[model samples]
Target chain A: MKNFIFQNPTKLVFGKGQIEKLSELIPLDVNLLITYGGGSVTKNGVYDQVKKALKGRSYTEFWGIEPNPRVETLRRAIALGKVKEINYILAVGGGSVLDGTKLIAAGIVSDKDAWEIVLSGVAENQIPFASVMTVPATGSEMNGGAVITREETHEKFSFGGDYPQFSILDPEVTYSLSDHQIACGLADAYTHVLEQYMTTTGQSRIMDRWAEGLLLSIIEIAPKIKESPNDYELMADYMLSATLALNDFIRMGISQDWATHQIGHELTALHGITHGHSLAIVMPGTLRELKVQKHDKLLQYGERIFNITEGTEEVRVNKAIEKTEEFYRSLGLTTRLSEENVGEDTIETIARRFNDRGVAYGENRNVTGDVAREILRKCI
Target chain B: MKNFIFQNPTKLVFGKGQIEKLSELIPLDVNLLITYGGGSVTKNGVYDQVKKALKGRSYTEFWGIEPNPRVETLRRAIALGKVKEINYILAVGGGSVLDGTKLIAAGIVSDKDAWEIVLSGVAENQIPFASVMTVPATGSEMNGGAVITREETHEKFSFGGDYPQFSILDPEVTYSLSDHQIACGLADAYTHVLEQYMTTTGQSRIMDRWAEGLLLSIIEIAPKIKESPNDYELMADYMLSATLALNDFIRMGISQDWATHQIGHELTALHGITHGHSLAIVMPGTLRELKVQKHDKLLQYGERIFNITEGTEEVRVNKAIEKTEEFYRSLGLTTRLSEENVGEDTIETIARRFNDRGVAYGENRNVTGDVAREILRKCI
Candidate 1:
């Protein structure tokens, strides 16, 4: 196992009516800024709950943080935070809003531009921030990483920063989510585990089992959630699984392959696909393209997660990749580029972008521009 | 699932050569007190490493915190800390030394005596403390709970307090551990997971899977570790599993049955058994006695961990309990009170103590003194 240092200090306030904890979670003296996305919280009663919880508390509000949280949008929140002298932020929406708030928190305290912070790949300093996490897809509630898009440049990049001081995850709020949102969330979480797990085997047995455990849980709940999305227990599993998936819990002392996420980010940046849906489309392709490199781990994953133990090694790897795409399809996501109307032009652009940056991705750092193009071509 | 608020802020610095990070991990400007056990570290070269890492830094050293960590020994450390005005503590031994330091940290800051703080069941305030953990069991390095024994009274009790600021866990330290110590550590970790997991089923699927994940990892590594005790990867798995097993990572929003631990502590206090060995002897008995309450979970554990399927419910439950005892025995620890030479008098003493204390344990709060007696009888 490789050497690693791990620490996550996010206080997770989870379960029913945890939203009421907002008043106490955030400190009383700080000048607060509550950030939100486009008005879903209003329809879902989350807004009312949050307001009632912090009754008589004075705070500035910043709304309109969009999906795939753009740096263009977050600059405005940072400006508003600067004017309000907001020392702390409470993000009250989905991953995008929280991701945007992360940038705002950094931008508020620094002279660097919001986009410049994203480009820097690490936020040196940030105002304190917490969240009333209404969505579970990106795991922004607990992790320090945030992906921000530059709309004009069609670029999406992630930056690491301070974790939330606290996150209130009331899974009951998810009862109002659309089926498509739920599907995308499940896909995102599954792909998150795969990113950490589908690497070289024998690094750490506990990590492998944990990554597989989350995969098994996500696979089991994806179907049941479709039938009973309002079931408190099912949604709780989904919410917790998403948070634990990418919160640095399962990647301890292990090699990780995030090539699929890098490709998926391009899909989201160029074609405006949902982050998780893009992963559902691209992850299978990456697996197929890099099957030989990931062969042993794939065989183990196939046997444990997909129960594909009866086949030959080559056949089992293929079956595992097929089963992965099928799992996404089972969640009502289209797992092909053509199905989403994303063609060769977009794929070539992503390849050229990778080439321009002179970068290689994945566990072994071999997924260069040509490899990316090949992977995308397979998806097509 | 239950409503819960969870947070752990201990930064885990793991892998080889991590002890050198002490200079950077601990602050420069503090009166630091370094605590130690009965000089195992001195023979193991850990003492030399720690001394080299903190060279040119002046600090007080308190030695001779024995196994199970007594309040008597800790009071001397506390008095020394108070005299030196120590604000920071770096415990450089196993769990017992760290556990003792936790109390000393609390006692130095409060007017109450160390034993009073232990009986209070919670330490309201404690000076900051970190650890260079040399043992793989107890998980005191990463958790907020500590078990301290009162040698004079033959009493053992636990208290909740602040987590370590950081913990350096280099699995290479395990190379110096005796075979019996390794066996006890493995059994301790395995039982820790069961205490959290072998309760109600369906409280949280992710929690169950994660718990099972740890269990499976421990089981798979136990025998391999016995053969290859010096293997870095196997020992790393063992070390990491022990930390993760009790670090509040698995018990989120779930009921836990610590009845085995409660009963095991009595065995330790009365007969002077090692903490982990006592658990090995008591855990299977707890399972056998409470199998009816833990029916579904036992069956699930049976199927998942031991693959004990194809039987009636009672048969499966019995097989699971038997397999649990067998696992402990395979670790080279005795799983019966009689094997340890304890008999009816000790059982009655434990029962009388529990009855006098008016304490009922386990998930349902029904493991009263009578139930404790029955469980002890099963062990016999």
Candidate 2:
């Protein structure tokens, strides 16, 4: 196993009515700014609950942090934060709001432009922030990484910074989510585990088992959740699984392949596909194109996750890739580029963009522009 | 699932040559106290590594914290800490050294005696402490709980407080461990997962799967470790398993049964068994006595961990319990009180102690003194 250091300090306040913890979770003395997305929280009663919990506490509010959290939008939040002298932030909606608020927190404390911070790839400092996490996708609640898009440039990039001081995850809030949102969330979480798990085997046995466990739980709960969306236990599993998936818990002392996510980000940026849906389409393609490189792990994943043990090595690897795309399709998502109307022009654009930047992604750093084009061509 | 709040802030620095990070991990200004066990580190070269890492730093050293970590030995360390006004502590040996340092951390900051703090069941305040963990047992590196013995009264109790600031776990340091220590460490890690897992089913599917993952990893690594004790990957798995088994990561929003640990602590206090060995002997007894109450979970454990699916419910439960005992025995530890030469007198003493304390344990709070007696008899 490779050497690693791990530490996550986000206090997870989870379960029913945990939103009531907002008053205590956020500090009493700091100048607070509560950030939110478009008005879904109002319809879902999350806004009322958050307001009631923080009753009599003075704070500013910023709304309309979009899904692929645009940098153009977050710059305004940063300006508002600077004017208000906000020392702490409370993100009240989903992952987008929290991801935007991360940039806002960084912007409030530094003279760097919000887009510059994203380009820097790390925020040197940020004002403290907590969240009333209403969405389970992206795992922005507990992790330090955030992906923000530049609308003008049609680009999306992630940056690392301080984790939330606390995150209140009341699974009951998820009962108001749309089916499409739920599907995307499940796909995002499952792909998060695959990014950390579908690498070289034998690096860390515990990490492998843990990644598989999360995959198994996501797979088991995905169908049951469709049947019973309001079931407290099922949503709790989904919420917790998403947070644990990307919170550095399963990637300790191990090689990780986020090539699928890198390609998916381009799809989201260029064509405005939902983040998780893009992954559902692109992950299978990456797996199929890189099957030989990931052969051993694919066999293990096939056997452990899909019970595909009665096949030859090559057949098992193919079966594993097929089963992965099928799992995403089972989530009511389209697992092909053509299904989303993304064609060769967009694929070539992404490949040329990668070539222009001279970037090679994945565990072995071999997924160059040509490899990405091949992966996308397979998806088409 | 239950409402819960979870947070762990200990930074785990793992892999070879991590002890060199001590200078950067600890603060430069605090008055530091370095704590140790009975000089195992001296013979193992860990002592030289620690000293070399902190060469220019001024610190005090306290030695000779024995197994089970008695309050008697810790009081002197506490007194020394008070005299030196030590505000930071670094434990450089195994769990015993860290456990004793936990108490000393509490005692130095409070007016109450060390034993009083232990009996209080919670330390309200403690000076900051970190560890260079040399043993792969007890999980004191990442958790806030510590069990300390009162040698004068033959009593053992646990208390909870602040977690370590950081812990350095270099699996290479485990190469010097004796075979018996390795066996006991493996058993301790395995039993730790069982205490959290072998309760009611369906509280949280993710928690159950994660706990099972740890159990499977431990089971797979135990025999291989016996043959290749010096293997880095195997030892890394073992070390990481011990830390994760009790690190509050798997017990979120779930019922936990520490009854085996409760009885095992008594065995340690009375008969002077090693902590892990005591658990090995008492755990199977607890499972056998409480089989009816833990029926569903026992069946699940049997099916998942040992693949004992070819039997009736009762037969499967019995086989699970038997397999648990056999696993411990295969670790080269005796799993029965009779094999260890303890008899009815010691059993009665432990039962009377529990009865006098008026404590009922287990998930249902029904492991009373009578149940304790029955469990002990099963062990016999």
Candidate 3:
């Protein structure tokens, strides 16, 4: 196992009607900014609940943080926060709102441009932020990562900042989500586990089991959630799984492969695919292209997750990949590039972007630009 | 899932050679009190590492916190801390040392006797403390629960206190543990997961899977660790599993049954049985007596952990109980009172203790004194 330091201090307030505790969770004296995305919280009654909870608490509100939350929108929130002297941010919608709020938190404390902070790859100083998480994808409620899109350049990049001081996850609030959003959330959570788990084997047995446990739970709940998205228990599991998936709990002392996410983010940037849908399409390609490199772990994952034990090595690996794609499809997601009308031109553009950045990803750092292109072609 | 709010803020610096980082982890402005066990660290070279790390930094050392840390010994440390006005504590030994430090942390701040704080069951204020953990048992490194025994009264009780600021867990430090200690540590970790998991079946699928994940990891590692106790990877898994088992990660929004632990603590208090050994003996008995109430979970645990699927309902439950006892015996701990040579008297004492407390445990709130007697009879 490798040397690592792990600490996540996000207080998870979870279950039914948890948003009402928001007023008590946040301190009384801070100048607060409540940030949101494009009005879904309003339709879903989350905004009303939050407002009622904070009835007389003084705060400023900023709306219009978009899906794949863009810096262009977040700059406005930061400007509002600066003028209001906001010391605390309460993001009240999906992952996008929280992602944008992370930037505003950092922006309020520093003179750095919001995009510059993304480019710098780390934000050390940030005003405190909490979340009333209405969406279960991206794990922005509990993790330090935020992927911000630059609309003009068609680029998306992530920066590390501070975890939310608290996140209120009322699963009942997810009852009104669209089927597509639910599908994407499940896919994102499942892929998050795979990215952390499908690396080298035998680094840490507990981490391996934990990563597999989340995979098994996601796989088991994906179909059940489709049957009953409003089932409080099912959505509760989904919400908690997403937060735990990428919150640095499963990656300790272990190698991780985020290559699929890097490629998927490009698909979202260039072609405007939903973030989680892009992963559903790209992950199978990653597994197939890198099969030999990931052979042993694939065999283990195949046996443990899919019960694919009664087959030859090649057959089991194929069955594992097939089962993965099936799981995403079972979530009502399109698991192919052609289905989304993405092809060689966009794939080449992503390759160029990766090449221009001079970066390699994955556990062994071998998923270079050309390698990413090969993986994408397999998706096509 | 149930309504829950959860947070743990202990920073874990883990791997080989992590103890050297402690000097930098603890601030130097406060009067520091370093606590230890009876000099096992001195022979194991952990003492030299800690001393070398803290060279040129002045601190008082408090030694001789025995296993199942007694409040009597801790009172002296608390009195010393009061005299010195020690503002920070660095517990530099095993769980017992840290457990005692937790009480001293609370005891130094108030005029109340240490035993009074233990009986109150919660310490609202405590000075900051951290640990350089040398044992892989009890999970005191990452959690706020502490179990302290009072030697004079032969009483053991637990209380909620503050978590450590940081903990340095170096797997290499576990090389010198006695075989009995290792056996108990494995059993402790395994039972910790069971206490959280062997309750209602469908409270949370993710929590069940995570609890099952820890159980499987412990079962797989226990025998291998017996053969090669110093293997870095195995010890690292063992260490990480112990911390994760009780760190509030698996118990979110779920009911927990610590009835076995409640009974086991009494056996440890009365008969001086090792903490883990007592659990190994009591847990199977708890399962056998409560199999009807815990039938579904026992069946699930049977199928998942031991693969005991080829039997009728009653047969499967009985086999599950048998397999649990077998696993503990395989850990080199006695599974029955007969094996430990403390049969009826110890059982009677434990039951009386529970009866005197007028409390019930388990998911059904029915593991009362009479039920405990039945459980104890099963052990005998």
Candidate 4:
């Protein structure tokens, strides 16, 4: 167990019709900017509910933040926010909007360019922001990290900032989501827990159990959610699981491996794959390539999450990796690179990027550029 | 799932040698009052570490807050705090001391009488406070709820107040705890999870899995801890389990049953038994008496925690209850009132107390005075 400090102050207002809390959750006197992505909230009734709640309250709206939350798009939002003297940000769509808004919030109050903030990898000052979270992926609603992309350069990077002042998560808003979005969301959430859990075994027993619990939950609810997407109980579990996965709740005093996510981001950046589906493809590859290094935890994860106890050590590890890929495929996603039309060029590009950055990731800091290339080739 | 607003802002500084952070964690400008229990910290070297960290800081120490944390002792601390014009509190001992300091924090700032505040059952305003937690029980470190007793009247009650500003939990500090204290702490953490769980079935599967994860972790670690109490990893898990059990993380949008805790409080108040040990005695009894109402959850608990899947529903439920009692006994705590030298007179007294208050507890509010009496008799 490592010495660490943990604090998250995002007030989660969850359940049906919780968007109405927006009026009370935000201060009325603050000049507010409600941010959105491609106007999905307008179709889903979330915008109407938010408008109804903020009736007569003075606020501006910033729309058309893209799926990957591009830096160029957020620069315009920041300029609009600066011109409007916006003091608070309310992100009204999915993770992309919230992720963009986080950058916009920081850029509004700082002289630093939005891209500079992303390059620095952290934002120290930000206008207070809250969310009417319409998606259960990325966990941007409760966490302090945001991934922003540069369309021109084909790069994506995450920056840390203040958490939302509050997040209203009404699960019913997810009823209209496309099947691919739902599949990507589930994969993202499951991979989030795995990123934090599949590292250094025996650090903390309770943390291991908790991480396994979230993984098991995502696995159990994934199929049931496909059968009945609007089932209140099923979506409720999914919403809760997504938030819990990245909310600093399960990673206490433990080593974590985000190598899969680091690789997945490159896939999203270079080839425009959806964030969660990229993880669905890359996580199995990372596991298969690193199975020996993560042997014990993979065995425990296999037994606890997949009931794969009747196998030799190597067999169990292989089965765990196979079951992981199968789980993602079960969610209507392809876990192989070639199936997605991605090839060696993108892999080499990502490897060159890691090499240029002179960086290593994962718990042991051994997932270097060459290692990432190996994992991607395994995926191919 | 229910509509809920969740926020806890306590900064948890966890792991090895975290107490050294106190010098930087607490602000030097505040008038700080350091509170403690009956000098166990002095013997354990925690007091010296705290004093060394706070050498140049202006602070005063208040000692002798006993087990269960009586209002009588708290009033003295409150009076002293008022005299010192203390605006910050740092509780340096176990949960008892921290619990008493919670009242002191509320009382020093309020015009209401100390007992009146307790009778009101909630403190809306409190001076900022933090803790250097030396015990792995009660979870007062990360939550806003505190259980305080009135020795004069033999009454115990809980009140809601400000969460700690920060808490430092160094697992090494728990190495000196007695076998009995360790047993009681483990029991307290386990029952805390059950109180939040063991209620309505299928409301939230993620929450259920999280609760079960804590239960399984405790069950798996309890015996290992008995053998190696000073093992850093085991104690880290134990400490984290206690904090997470009651930290509002697992109870989101879920029904909770604290009937066992309600009855157990009376046992602590009347018989002077340790609070957690009392719960260990009474919880199995509560399960036995309310098995019909909690049948589904009991079966799930049995299957998940104890693996009691080879029986009929009724048989499985009974076995779960029996296994719960057996686990407590294995922790070297008595699971029956008679074994602890209490009898029918005490049970009737508790029943009368509940009846006088006209209070009902549990998820369904059915654990009335008579039900409590029945539960206590079962414990006997």
lDDT of 1 by residue, A4-43 (tens): 9999999999989888878878889999999999999999
| B186-217: candidate 3 lDDT, tens digit per residue | 99999999999999888988888889889999
Residue range A7-118, candidate 2, lDDT tens digits: 9999999989888888878879999999999999999999999999989989999999999999999999999999999999999988999999999999999998999999
Residues forming the 10-long window of minimal summed lDDT in candidate 2 chain B: B361-370
Q: Which stretches of candidate 1 lie over 4 Å from their true place?
A: none
Interface RMSDs of all predictions?
0.6, 0.6, 0.7, 0.9
Off by over 4 Å in 4: none
Mind giving the per-residue lDDT tens digits that candidate 4 earns over B67-143? 99988888899999999999999999889999999999999999888888888889979999999999999999999
Taking all chains together, the TM-score of candidate 2 against the true structure is 1.00
Interface RMSD of 3: 0.7
Candidate 3 chain B worst ten-residue window by lDDT: B342-351
DockQ of 2: 0.92
Estimate how well candidate 3 is docked, as a DockQ score: 0.91
Lowest summed-lDDT stretch of 10 residues in model 2 chain A?
A18-27
Q: State the fraction of real interface contacts model 3 keeps.
A: 0.92
lDDT of each: 0.94, 0.95, 0.92, 0.92
* Candidate 3 lDDT (Cα, 0 to 1): 0.92
Lowest summed-lDDT stretch of 10 residues in model 4 chain B? B52-61
CAPRI class assigned to model 2 = high
